[model samples]
Target: MEFAADVFPGGPSDPSVLTQYADHVAGSVWTGEERLELKLSSHGKKVHSLGRSVPAIEGLVIGTRLSPLIACSVDTGDQGLLSSFVERWHRETSSFHLPVGDVMITLDDVSSLLHLPMVGDLHVFQPLHMDDAVQMLVDLLMVSAEAARAETGQCRGLYVRLQWVRDIYKRRCHAGHWTAASREYLLHLLGCTLFANKSATNVHVVFLEALRDLRYVVHGISYTT
Candidate 1:
């Protein structure tokens, strides 16, 4: 199917928006255990897409994976953030490698995409007191996963989403600027999100991979363990 028209007609190219979107998901998201789902109708009704994620899993996914996935951006607060995030996300999904769009998705990507929850773009930013960038990552992941699980998926329209995310992330890592404290905190948060998210996604990926490898259940036909 033809992908939706550019979400940011007057704002920026899909590639630029990809960078800004990832930044928002990484740093600004709230720090909590609440599942999230989002239907982003912003930037002049340009991008019509819906996504979701779980509170707990969001923490796990962002807190774990690394390299060309997603990242935090406290500098321009809109750039380089995606890289920080996907860097971790890619690491988390390393085991599955399912081709989650343009990016060869791994089991983590598939499962996370399968289970992601939904909320709204309004919730992307956390309260002032909340500074756990890692938590934000997890929450965003959960939301993304839920959107992915839907039968009418955004993924169907876009194949380069993952690759796009990774590319944006790389740009951020090389170009983003931040305070020493913010940098340190975010770095720490990145580690936290990486371990947490990767651990969670890996469990799902490994389990499914094992099941597939073992053929425990094929086409709904049960195989003896």
Candidate 2:
């Protein structure tokens, strides 16, 4: 079962060779008919729609460094193209093995593409106990303790439904409750855009830490993929 040097070239390190092999097998020899389907939800669209109606919180939004994101829309374009690139991703190399060569996404790319700040403290999240999670939700979101406990329980103390957050936003996103409204808006923005998960139904509760002090949201924190 010996393969000639020309067939494999630089062995596992050669992205060009690996890409060619993958293309040959996937395009001609592979028998599988199913293709990868992305599960990105319409959560971003929902957030954008809400942002349009919600009263402006310029000071809060600017402090959080998320003002740019408010104007952006999520466009999950060309699923087939995205899936193809996903298939070409090689974890070991941390890049895509494409015919053009190996390509890796850097922090600069994210900053430029999303119009987000790159200079800041690293965004780190720590898990919380159920009691702590519930309290934080109540304190930051202006929800009752009982309601917070129930929602935290539903997501195993790690997350809460974005729908729930949206509901809260609708009720409180006005001048009368600006402080609480700002917190809800930040949570919704992060969940629907930057830290979105596959489930699309919920957002991690840990993001609450960022909202505790709006002043630090922008210059104090930066997220990595």
Best by TM-score: 2
Candidate 1 lDDT tens digits, 54-117:
2323433333232122322112333344334442332223322123533454445533543322
Q: In candidate 2, what are the lDDT values of residues 5-56, reduced to their tens digit?
A: 4545323445543455544324331446565456546665767667643445
Q: Considering summed lDDT, which 10 consecutive residues are worst modelled in model 2?
A: 22-31
Error of 1 at 172 (Å): 0.5
Model 2: pairs clashing at backbone N, Cα or C within 3 Å = none
What TM-score does model 1 achieve against the real structure? 0.15
Give stretches of model 1 more than 4 Å off: 1-160, 177-225
How far off is residue 41 in model 2, in Å? Answer: 2.8
Report the error of model 1 at residue 101, Å: 34
